[model samples]
Target: MSSYSAPLRDIRFTLFDLLDVESSFARLGFDEAGRDLVDPMLDEAARFAGTVLAPLNKAGDEHGVRYDKDSGSVTTAPGFAEAYRQFTEGGWSGLSAPAEFGGMGLPHVVGMPLEEMINSANLAWGNFPLLSHGAANALQHHGEDWQREVFLGKLVTGEWTGTMCLTEPHCGTDLGLLKTRAEPAADGAYSITGTKIFITAGEHDLTPNIVHLVLARLPDAPAGSKGISLFVVPKFKVGRDGAVGERNAVRCGAVEHKMGIHGSATCVMNFDGAQGWLVGQPHRGLMAMFTMMNTARLGVGLQGLGLAERALQNALRYARERLQSRSLSGPKYPDRPADPIIVQPDVRRMLLTCKALVEGGRALGYHAGLQVDLAAHAGSEEERRQADDLLGFLTPIVKGCLTEWGVECTYHALQCFGGHGYIAEHGMEQLARDARITTLYEGTTGIQALDLMGRKTMQLQGAGLKVFLGMVQAFCEQQAGNAALAEFVGPLAEKAREWQGLTMAIAKRAAGDPEEIGAAAHDYLFYSGYMVLAYWWARSVAAAEASSQPQAFRDAKRETARFYFARILPRTLAHKAAIETGPAPLLALDEAAFDA
Candidate 1:
């Protein structure tokens, strides 16, 4: 079996050493976000995650949730409600919320590590509060003044919870195909009637009300995504003055029995002419909905990172404790009948793979979180725009790569445990199962690739790419004098140049043949992800070398970066080759040929 202690040392290294977030926060007008205050919050967050949430992970997976068909009510896994209450009482929901709305008003970067810990401790339990961040994002950017007053504060304070209700049985990624209908009600609220599938935390006992940010087409709506609108539909209706009223028409129809994350209710939500008010402009709901989706996309990336961390920790511990044959070179621990499996080279390969991806990914993910803060709070509009651009560029790569790696890391971690890993008691299998959904739910990896290529690259003309490449160039120049970082700097710079050329190449190809985008998108995204991680891995080595961390820690970072460069980063080469193939290779296989 495995356990999780918050990876505080590495988290701090990422936050302060790599990102220098305290300085960044101060520069962005967060006076109270200094390390003095942030440190204690981190400690408390770790304590709560470890002591409370960690114990519940296995229980949640095993017991899942209890659903009453007659009442259409769902009781979450044991202790889930209590833990959620504690989470709210501890004021964690407001960690990155605006101070004006009853939140602590900390920077999102500050909340990033805390979020990782929560997910690591219990992925299922973490689902309860995760969407609130997105719901709050949608409301903050798009909600009307009265709507904000009526609902936003409660969401920020965790007095209530929130969900994104977008998918129906017929469509998921294609929001334009959704058939949910929203008609005008007498009191100015919309009457929403639809069945939303795969709704996380759709109905639960954790809070008195669940605010659903639903996407539905209006009576006069056009045929596709452009015509959709956003609405705030709550389970228990509330008055304009903020007082809770009678139950609305929204209810849980059924809970899915899934492969993983059983503790969290994945409900089929039925909105039976539910009363909700409009959010943002009509026919602009997709725009507003994306505000929530982009936020959730980043959050989902961390889900993968979080699972990798827990799985790696468990596997590493197993490697050290489990006895196997002596090392091929020689016996390292002669006292035991056999040396620990950790002495074996192949075992080291699996462990190190997890280590390199997990550590480097943490830094990359944390850096993106910092960009979010800068995007919102930077000194100038131009600065904010640049930050947002960089963030957009990184989002798909972060989500796509990290989630795919999360599954990979968990697989390797489980492999390290051998047969025991296959057994449920080892808990590695549960992690592997849980990590599967991250990539699938928040726009599948394929969808993320399309977004990166189609929207971010082609439509925006690689604005985000330009911003990121500029950072890579600036970093390489700044670190030129540091001989210790020279090894990584040279390769990273080479990759950065290659990435720019590769982008131009693909854009040129797609210009001639539109199918080139689809053909190259998946591989191009992986290539970008590998390059991004390479940059972060290089930065991590520099951060470790420059910090006051112990020599062993520094050496470990150096060695892991070496492993990444040698083993993992080269995956880009294969992706690049695939990207250059155009569309002929894929499209040559006609639909009938496969069956024939």
Candidate 2:
């Protein structure tokens, strides 16, 4: 059986000691809910995650979800309904929802860590409610007065779940090719008729109704992405009296048989003249969708983080208990036939790499969460704009780099367990399988790369990049003289410089020849990702040095940062070389050359 125990100590350390999360809340005018409230909330969240949700993960995977074609309803795995009941009963679904909509109004800084724990415990179960948050975000951003009043409270309270409907059979990435139709109907509503595929949490029995934030084209809409519009299509139509009325013309055609996260119901949804309300102005659906998409991108990155943490835990537990060969110096456990594998340096390296990435990812995620809060609640407009600009620049990097590192970290963790890791019982293999989608969905790494190189860097004329580099440069300057961090800081500074130079080079090349951007996108994404991680690691080391913690803990932080720069961060060199090479080799290849 797979079990999860939230790393509460680590969570506390990251929030208070490392990042000073309380001070961040204070800065955002949230002092009334200080550490006293924050601490207990986190404790309860961790308890729920470890006790209720974690145990269901393996069972859910084993049982999975079953679809009834006749009834058009999907039955979730055993214990899921009860788990969701407990989850909503505890008000978790409303942790960060707006107060006016029956929520606690907690900021992302507080909500994010809780999200990590829930995801780490059971991603499949966590996903059911996670989508609601995304849907609520979109609605709050672009919804009408009645739309907010009618849907927001129920969504916040988990009375109904939500989903984003963008992908179709023929269109996954390119929305311009989407054929879903949204025609204006009587009574000022739109009639949405389309087939959306890979819709997670699209249809489930856990809630009474599922709200789908769908994208479709109007009858007189222009072609391409500009023609798209967002609509809110509920499974059960609501009457004017705030009661369920008619069963809408929406149904789940089928559910996908996926590689992992089997418990999460991915449905092929069919909309047959479903009644839906327009979210934003016509030809502006992509803009409305981005509100949810950006949040989903970050949420997916955390999925990678959660899976990596699970993989590392399983590997470390096995390494410590499993006896194998003797240690290099001698047999430490002579009583046993051999020695535990953790005594080996290679195993330690693998474990440390996973640890470093997870911890560093936590810092990166928290920083981004803080940015989100600042952007929303900053005292001055200028302060909010700066925070928004910086966060916008890093969002792709956070989503792209963290998820990529997540796969790598999980793979390494699986390797640490040797053959046992491949077995189904250990659950490490499942982590790798589940982590795979993090890179694919919510935008592929290639897409993220293009977004970073083509859109983020070049589109803004390097305004975002300049803001990011300035922050990094300031951090480097502040930490340059720290005796304990000098070694880590120097290399990180160099990597940042290299990253900046590479960004400029790619930008210049992309300006002259647009083809160069495609060729360099992936490499540029990797290079940028490494630089961000390196910078984060260095900042973490500085914080560790300033802490009053035990020497062993501090030493581990410093050592892990060193390992990141030496072993992991150096991969950027290859990526940089590839980026500098531009579109020559990639474009030069003939069409037949790819026939293999």
Candidate 3:
């Protein structure tokens, strides 16, 4: 198996150079999270991730997880328990949790790169802590004082893991169709009775207790999404004294046999009259869950960026070592039997695609993380509201675009390995398999696309879009006079205008036929994502050019930025055409005719 290493240089560049975490931390009131502290933490995290977690990845995939039917529990792959022990012992799980709850309380900007490093090293192993962060977000925001005292501390301390129980056999993305029941009980709690499927870290042996944030409906509650309520259901019951007690009615009925992330237990949880405390008010579950959902959505985007970074590293290493046909122009290595594959233009194309995607995606993801910090800690209300709006608008784009690009980058990386890539021993195949789920879960690409086009843009009347568009326009105008950046600035300005025009067109059309929104959703999503990336790529070039960095680094950024504009950004043109094609072609075929 190929060894995995965290790309610390690029990560540092992204954090300190592109996102400017030092300034951000200062502004956000995170005094303790300056570079002096964050750097050492990142170094330790990189060591833990690269040395401890990366080695477990292939072994985890091969061994998978063991389900004990009798105990109704799951055991993870070898070394998982000990690795998780070290992970939590290092206080890594609480990197961004609340300080009052036994956490480090760093900004998301710092935590996000650490997250990328871990996910890159071992995604399957990363899932265990990943879900805990989401659960913490939910509890911190909505949990009652008693509830926080009971559950929040353990979650932040990593003594217990957490899971989000929303999906059932009947429904996945559509939470409105959920049938889980939450009945009132005599103890002022509710009895949750239903089954949740595809629960990550649902039932694992790594922790003593598991906290589940479940969504269920009350008998007298109104129908659909509005009637749902959020509850904190533990695997083992906790007393008012905050001690673990007897097992609750919640149990893992079965573990899923999935294509990837086998080390992470994705289980079918059955809640048969399980005792649970409501986190937020009744019928406001969807709103409460958004706190976690939004966090998870952004985390999912990092998962994509992580996998792509790992894939790029392994592919670049292989490309430089593997001997293949001679270079098209001439043999770059005269002494060797044949030139390395890296000498070939086609191979460079694939490699550069991966490079550009991962780097640009990193900037986008980290920028969003900075927005998260601003939303939480900005000094002024106006700054907080603007940051929150931009974060909301970019969530779906980050989740949808990055995951799909992760898949693309992995495929390219695997192709670089040729026949060897298909084999399990090489580990590229595992990365490919794991990348597939990022898009399907959290929310599928189509779901994110719909959210971006319908709910975020049209429903809100482009409030978020206006904020982002303004940023792009301002940047483009500033760079218009810079001759060194004209190649990028001019096109980016044009694309920004087109993006705004497209939104207006879609809004108008949707007013007459709602299907118009659905029709243009997927296309608009890619179009918006590509445009966002274009802006970032341009900014990266400008940053690199103005920096005191070495000439090679600046050259690489300029070259990659050029490649992105010339090759990938043109993809938006196709998306634009497809959007204009409207819903007619897609909806033309009758049901019987489609089947035929």
Candidate 4:
């Protein structure tokens, strides 16, 4: 059976040591988020994740979700419903939500590690809350006061679940081509008619009711994306008094039989004149939905990080136990029949790659999470703006790079198991399968790359990049005089300069030809991701040197940092070259000529 243990120590290190989250709490004026409360929450979350969710992962994968055509409902894998019960009872659904709305009102930074732990334990099961978090974010930001009172409380308290219904059969990322229609109703609500596909937790048995945040166009609206509007369509009509009423017109047509995350109910939702209330002003849906989508993107990045951590943990265990051919130089474990696979150079490479990527990623992801807390709670308007800018810039990279690396880490992790990894019993293959979707959903890596290089950088004129560069420069300058940090400071400073120079060059090239943006976009994103990660790695090394933690823990951090700089960071060189190459070679091949 597959196994998972929450990396609580590492998580604490990332939050309390590397990021200094205590100061963040003080700055945000979250008086309730003292060490006494945060530590217990983290400890309990880890225990729940390990004991309740991890065991069900394999069973969930094997049994999957059962869809009943006649009933138009879904039954999740066995134990999933009960586990969700415990999850809600624990008040995890509202961990980061407002206290007035029946939530704990914890810092978003604190929620990040809890989320990572839950996802690591069981990603498919984690989908239930992940969707709720996104849905609550949308409603909290754009919903009318009455709507929040009616819907947001339940979503926060885990009494009901939420889903974002956007993708239809005809379109995925392009919201403009959506054919869903919303007609005006005499009751002051709208009648929604649309078939939204690939809705996560769209129709499930986990809750008493499901709240769907849908996107549809009004009858009098203009064409394309500008015409779209947001709506709150509940499975059962919710009265103003919070009473669950009669069934709505919404129904599940079918649940997708996908390659992975099978325990998650990816459903085809049909709203046949379903009653829905408008979320924001008419024809301004995308603007509001972004509040949810952006949050989901960051959560998805954590999903990647969680999966990689699990993969690395399992691989490390197997590598030390499984004996194979003797080491090339000599057997490291002379007492063994041959030697443990950990002695193999390639095995170490794979394991260390996973290590460097995952730990480096943890630091970056948590820092982004901290930025979220800062943006929401910082006192000064300028502080909030800068935090918002940095958070916006890092979102796509965190989502894209971390998910992509999640895939790569799983590949290496499975390889460490050798032929046994492919077998279902070993559970390595399942991780690989589960990780494949992180890149596809919330927005594909390509879409994220475009958002980073095109919208975030080029369109915003690099305002976010300027803020990030300044942070990196400041970190480098702070560590310049410390002899222990000499190895990292010089290299980090150089990468920061190269990063700025690369962005300027891309901007200049795109000025000449806009198509150049798309061409260089993907590479530039990876380059940016590597540079950001490089900074975090260096910072981690500096932190490790100063920390009074056990020597082994500190050594691990330093070794991982050294590996990242020595191995992973050089990847920027290739991306830099590819970005400079521009769109010519990519556009050279004609569509028809290539096929012939």
Best by lDDT: 1
Candidate 4 runs further than 4 Å off: none
Error of 2 at 147 (Å): 0.4
Ranking of predictions according to lDDT: 1, 4, 3, 2
The alpha-carbon root-mean-square deviation between model 2 and the true structure, to one decimal in Å, is 1.4
In the range 473-556, model 4's lDDT, one tens digit per residue, is: 999888889888888889989988989998899899889899999998899888998898888888887777677778999999
- lDDT per residue (tens digit) for residues 346-441 in model 1: 899999999999998998898888899999999999999999999998899889989999999999999999999999988999999999999899
- lDDT digits (tens) for residues 335-445 of candidate 3: 999999999998999999999999999999999989998998999999999999999899999999999999999999999999999998789999999999999889999
Q: How much lDDT does each candidate structure score?
A: 0.92, 0.86, 0.91, 0.91
TM-scores of the models, in the order given: 0.99, 0.97, 0.99, 0.99
* Model 3, global lDDT: 0.91
Regions of model 2 farther than 4 Å from truth: none
Better of 1 and 2 by lDDT: 1
Alpha-carbon shift of residue 556 in model 2 (angstroms): 1.2
Q: For residue 322, give model 1's deviation from the true position in Å.
A: 1.0
Per-residue CA lDDT of model 2 for 111-210, tens digit only, reads: 8878888878898888898888889999999998888889999999999999999999999999999999998987888999999999999989899999
